[model samples]
Target: MKLKITVLFIAFISSLTIAQTKVGTIDSEYIIGMMPETKKVVEITKSYGAMLDSTFSIRVTDFKVRLEDYKLKEKDMGELEKKTIQKELAGLEQDIKKYQKNGNTLMGLKRDELMRPLYTMLSEAIAFVAKENGYTQILTITGNEFAYIDSKFDITELVLKKLGITIPKG
Candidate 1:
């Protein structure tokens, strides 16, 4: 009787362990990008790009008009006068280039600054969801990797929801 009971208990414990499913997979970038914070980050980047683009447009338009004015005066000007104007225009162009370079650097820094907070939040959310849902492991599927995962085992939607991402109804 004792042997039978011990065997039954071990079998039950093994069955319980076997009953728990282990699942993992890679999520599409498109799906991850739909997170609300990700959308906000994209919007911020677009706004910065638009500002830089408009600034460049205005500067180029002004420079073109200035260049035309200089060309019209070239016939009446001495060599020194023409050289001075050319130097000034060259300096202006250099300034514009510097501005663009600085804008790119600043935009990158700002984007990273903004993303840090969001990343921390997302990490916490993922942890919370993983713990609550008993997710033993969740793997990120990136490019050039084939993870053997069943589509039915994906918990991406649940994780997204835990991160406060709202799923749109089809």
Candidate 2:
């Protein structure tokens, strides 16, 4: 009787472990970008990029005009004033180039800053959904890196549907 009881206990524990190991993978990028909140974030990102670009353009033109005026009067200015003007102009030029180079929504540090919170929220949501559905584990595999995931294991469709993403069929 004790041996049967021990076997049952061990079986129960094994099942519990198996249950907790429920795994799922998300095309996290797809999910995040699909959500409505992402649309707002994208607009914000675009606005920020435009603002940076306009600001940089104004600063560059303003600084260039000032530098030209300083150069025209360099002979009358003290060495200290000349050096200070050159340094300021150089700094402004650098700012213009840096802002221009980075003024794209696709490549800004703000992308990650905006995305991380969404990622965290997704993670929490995933955990909640998985527990409710008795999933034990979740994994994300990109197309480039994933060579062989069985179609049955590909829960992307199910997850997207569950998340209310109605992807159109091609």
Candidate 3:
């Protein structure tokens, strides 16, 4: 009789633990896209991209002008002088390529800088909503990696609500 009672107690505890686990999914990207403040971030990112593009364009223009000048003067230049100009032009060409690579990296960094705060805000709101709703785990849906997640378990709308956002009706 005592063994039976102990077994029942253990079974009850296990059931409680299993029942406490509540998993939910949220699409944070959708939440961020819906945010009005994202417009400002987009504008700033575009401006930064344009600045990088212009810098690249100026370097290309400078290289072309120098190449033209070198071509015009190459005939009158001495051996050593010609070699010096050639070396300088080669270095400038390499520098321009390096600038283009660096510009791409800088643009990515700037985008992260702009998006960090919005992600942070969404993270905090998600946490609050999860705790309030007794969620044991929250997953983010990206692409179609998830074979299938029941819509009833999606807490995205709840999270948006927590952040005082309303999902626009289709």
lDDT tens readout by residue for model 3, 1-170: 99999999999999999999999998889999988779999999999999999999999999999999999999999999999999999999999999999999999999999999999999999999999989999999956488789999899999888888888888
Task: Note the Cα lDDT for every prediction shown.
Answer: 0.78, 0.75, 0.93
**Tens digits of lDDT, candidate 1, 1-170:** 99999999999999988767555653645445776778889899889889888998898888888999999999999999999999999988998899889888988998888788776766676667667777777676657476366776666787777766777889
Worst 10 residues of 2 by lDDT: 142-151
lDDT of 2 at 125: 68
lDDT of 2 at 156: 63
Give me the runs in candidate 3 sitting further than 4 Å from their true place.
none
Task: Report the candidate with higher TM-score, 2 versus 3.
Answer: 3
TM-score between candidate 2 and the true structure: 0.66
Clashing pairs in 3: none
State the TM-score for model 3. 0.91
lDDT of 2 at 148: 63
lDDT of 2 at 166: 78
Instruction: Tell how far residue 71 is off in model 2, in angstroms.
Output: 4.1
For residues 1-170, could you state the per-residue lDDT of candidate 2 as single tens digits?
99999999999999987766756666766777677778887888788777777877788789879888988999999999989988988888887777677666444678678777877877776776677667777677655476566655556666666667778778
Best by lDDT: 3
Kindly report which residue stretches of model 2 are placed more than 4 angstroms away from their true locations once superposed: 1-20, 71-81, 91-113
